[model samples]
Target: MISKLNLENILFLDIETVPETENFSDLDNTKQDLWEAKSRYQRKKDFTPDEFYDRAGIWAEFGKIICISVGYFNIEGDIRTFRVTSFYGDEIKILKDFKNLLLFHFSQTKHLLCAHNGKEFDFPYIARRMIIHNIELPYKLNLFGKKPWEVPHLDTLELWKFGDYKTYTSLKLLTNVLGIPSPKDDIDGSEVYNVYYKDNNIDRIITYCEKDTIAVAQIFLRLRGDDLLNDDEIKHI
Candidate 1:
């Protein structure tokens, strides 16, 4: 199946997000109530909304994107290098820069935005955030009326599932199964919130995001029965 698609046309991506505010206490009373309501289904009974706030980053309404790392293959003769870059900073700036990238370079209908579980998370989150920031949605990310076949989004997790909706697969597990080097050598998703909020380390988050982006691309290649890329072949820009 992967052999049918043009690898160069796919843009692999991953994002790191955090709660809009540093702490639950920072939210206005109305937002605090809203967050509590949103968390009621998922949070443990003993956990207060403030205690559960760290998980808010997974929700588009409650969180803000801090980093959006994207990668694409650059083919030159027999050499196929995967080049990665990231947009980091304030939420508005990050969204705007990413939008610019899409509009300026990857605007073609043949271009695709690929991520792990991107259909459920990264893709929609980016679209919502762009709306919040008053930035127009990039054509590739807009899927209001496009048929399933017309949507140019590729999700590695969905590809692995083969239509089984009940099972869940993490990018880490797929990488392990495919023999791709682990991207979680530093920190995982659970630690990203604290890393950004408490540690005030956006660079670290960008690094982690970039690794995940690369992992997604590698996993896609593996699905195509291709060899994993070496470190020297990964260009960071």
Candidate 2:
């Protein structure tokens, strides 16, 4: 039903993230410390709070967003095309450029932005980073004060709920169930931080991002009953 729900007003987005580190020490100063302490307590069976923070700091220092790939369906051609851009320089500048692109392309449209787990992670991350850079968020993104379900958000993960709140699904597993081809290759969620940190290869990041965007798009197509990808539509990185 979502497919017939107006493709003219949808923007598919995905983000790459590294753990928060710029103000890690500042966490010790506020109520956030309690949350951190609780998280540590929960994960105590694995690692201590200090050790976890230390390891996270190491990844934050080296883990950068190398690429952000965005895909949009071409209504005229009935084809989906994507653009994978790199952010190899300053993180601030990169975030700004990305924000600007969103503003330019999506500001005037009544578009429903969709992403996997975007409600929790990608959306807030981008909004906070934009504020840090003194950039105003675009209209569709100004949903901070709105109710989660009221907003024009189509999180595939949420849809998989199928009327059950406790039924959570991972993107990988959902794609498999839907018969969508999984693009997961040598890299995975855990390896993403390491790949970006250790190799510093933008191409690899771009590949990873493109695959994700494509997967999301395919999921949308299936929900809409539209034709999904054939061999020609796929681009392997």
Candidate 3:
């Protein structure tokens, strides 16, 4: 499938997210009850809602996107460069800018949005957050009546799955097996909340998000049986 697709047409992306608020106490009483109800299945019997609040970012309703970094392959004569860009700061502004990019540049039928485990996490999370912010959904993301195959969203994780339904693959595991450099060298998803709220380090989070986007693009290349990107071929824009 990847061999039939143009790498240049795929906009590879990854996002970093954090809990909507600094702590659980920040939520109102009704929301607190809702969170408790929503999280009870995952939280261990000993773990309270406050203790499990660190994981709120995984759900779009309880958390917000802090960084969304994207990369695309730019092929020149005998050379291929992957250029990366990121949108951070205010969530609504970030979503708006990203939506504009999609609307203006990648709105063509051949263009695709690619991410690892995007079908389950990144794609739906973005759509849900956009609705929450009352922003119009990008054409690629709005799947109101489109057939499954017509969605134009690519999931590297889904491709890797093939037919197996029981197994789950993490991006870190996929990169390790495929010989791509690890993107989680500095911080994994678990630490983003603390890094964003406690340390107040949006730059660090953006850098980490961009690394994951780069890794996603590299993984896609590997899936297409191409060589990993070289250091000189990476340009941060």
Candidate 4:
């Protein structure tokens, strides 16, 4: 039988992305005119079914990646307090910094990177954007050519397969099911883009990302057979 993995070496990360908009100006007048003409095209149809309109609007406006907030439990610290580090700035710079931090942590210890829908969205999105920025991907983020089962990824959504693949569960829903209070009140993923663009508030984006990180952490705790946090243990972003 395979041994159960330890949670001490795991890293839980979450990223908020927006679409690329800088190159829109580089398009010729004809292309620009065409884009302008297409602006009224039903915005709803433009996004993936799983994506929210607010998220799509963010991509439509101020490009993507307003913030990435990461939370991890320090194994060395006896108290179970989670430490958080957030990057909020120019998308490119924040990505670079986040990537570096990930790489640095990986280099020091063998960690199982965990996220909610990381396998489908967060991981690939970060990799693609890194390639766009000509940034080197850390070894942990480089999962190209690996078979699905061979990759060391723990997507909570994927783990839910044991319950029912057909029944999709949002992170918030899973948190509640696991007896962990949801920390999604401050701002949601949908409002991230609008908060960054219309409201000019990157802090909201950070809070949103932080909540996701905590949610993922709770999921990780449950998977490890540890006592999941109750309402008292839950922290607001």
Candidate 5:
């Protein structure tokens, strides 16, 4: 089924997120209490909510998207290139720009969104954040009232699972095993918060996001029995 889908019709995306506040202390009294309740089960008795705050970005309610890098294929005669770009800076602007892209371009029935763990993470995360920010949900991102088969989002991780849902595989590991070039050359997910907040390196984070997006597309191509893209074939727009 994947082999039949056109690669150019899919929008490969990856997002970088960070806690809404730089530190736990920065949260107001009400938000701090809510954070405690939200994180209590995960933090356990040994770890306080504030101590576990570094991972706040995993939850849309507690965090905000800082960057969303997207890649898509373009063909001109016999030439093929994958153009990548990023929507970043102010969260509202990021969400708006991304929404606009979906509404204006990828809104067609055949268009789809692809990400490594998009079904479980990226897709839903973006939707939740958009609702939180009061941004209108584009047709591609809005899943409400849609049946499972109607959803156009694709998750490479789910495809890799192939009915074994008990375990998980990172994009990095899958790429390594499938012989696709690793995208983790700079940093992994664990360091994103620090890189964004402490080092203040948004460009570095954008690069990492774009790499992951390209890797997602590459992984999908590999799954479909196609050749992996060369570095020279990737262009940042």
Candidate 6:
């Protein structure tokens, strides 16, 4: 099914998020209590809610999107180009810009959004954040009443699972095994919080996010038994 799909109709993307604030104390009293409850099982006995706050970005309720990098194929004649772009900075602006992209261009019934681990993370995370900001969900993101086969989304991690159900594969690990260039050369997901808060570097995070987006597209091409995209064919717009 993947091989028969049109690459031009798919939008590949990845997101980078950080806790809504720099510290756990930055949250209101009510939110702090909610954090403690939300993170209890994951943090375990090793870390307090404050100590585990760095990872709050994993949840849509606690974190805010700082960057969303997306890539789509632009084909003209025999030329192939994967145009990449990002919407970063203010969370509201970011969400609005993404929604605009979806509505104006990629909102068709044949269009689909693709991301790594998207079904579990990226897709829902975007939707939840948009709702928090009161941004209307785009057709691609709104899944309120959609049946299983009616959803217009694709996940690289889920594709790799192939009904294993228990398998989990990191993008870095998958790229390494599949002969695609690793997207984890520099900082990884774990280091994003510090890079954004402590180091005050968002450009680095944006670059990383775009790399992952490209890696996802490459992984999809590999899954379809297609040739990998060359460096010259990737354009950051």
Which 10-residue window in model 6 sums to the lowest lDDT? 133-142
Across 113-156, the per-residue lDDT of candidate 5 in tens digits comes to 99998998999999999999988899998888999999999999
Error of 1 at 179 (Å): 1.0
lDDT, residue 66, candidate 6: 100
Task: Work out how many backbone clashes candidate 1 has.
Answer: 0
Candidate of highest lDDT: 6
lDDT of 6 by residue, 176-231 (tens): 99999999999999999999999999999999999999999999999999889999
Ranking by lDDT: 6, 5, 3, 1, 4, 2
Minimum summed lDDT over a 10-residue window in model 5 is located at 73-82
> Residue-wise lDDT of candidate 1 within 142-219, one digit each (tens)?
898999999999999999999999999998888898888999999999999989888988889889999999999999
Q: What tens digits encode model 4's per-residue C-alpha lDDT throughout 1-237?
A: 012666656777888875444245555577456555555454446643223233342322324666777776645554455666788888789888888877777544357777897877777777777776788888677887877666666788877667576777888888888877686877767665566667878777777788788888888777767766544444443
List model 3 lDDT by residue over 1-237, tens digit each: 688888889999998888899999999999899999999999969799999999999999999998899999999888999999999999999999999989998999999999999999999999999999999898999999999889989988988999888889999999999988999999999999888999999999999999999999999888888889999999999
Task: Kindly provide the TM-score of model 5 when superposed on the true structure, using C-alpha atoms.
Answer: 0.98
TM per candidate comes to 0.98, 0.78, 0.98, 0.77, 0.98, 0.99
Ranking by TM-score: 6, 3, 1, 5, 2, 4
Compute the lDDT for candidate 2. 0.63
lDDT for 149 (candidate 5): 96
Local lDDT at 92 for model 6: 96
Better of 4 and 5 by TM-score: 5
In candidate 4, the residue pairs with backbone N, CA or C atoms under 3 Å apart (3 or more residues apart, or in different chains) clash, namely 18-64, 18-65
Q: State each candidate's clash count.
A: 0, 1, 0, 2, 0, 0
lDDT of residue 72 for candidate 2:
61
Error of 1 at 124 (Å): 0.5
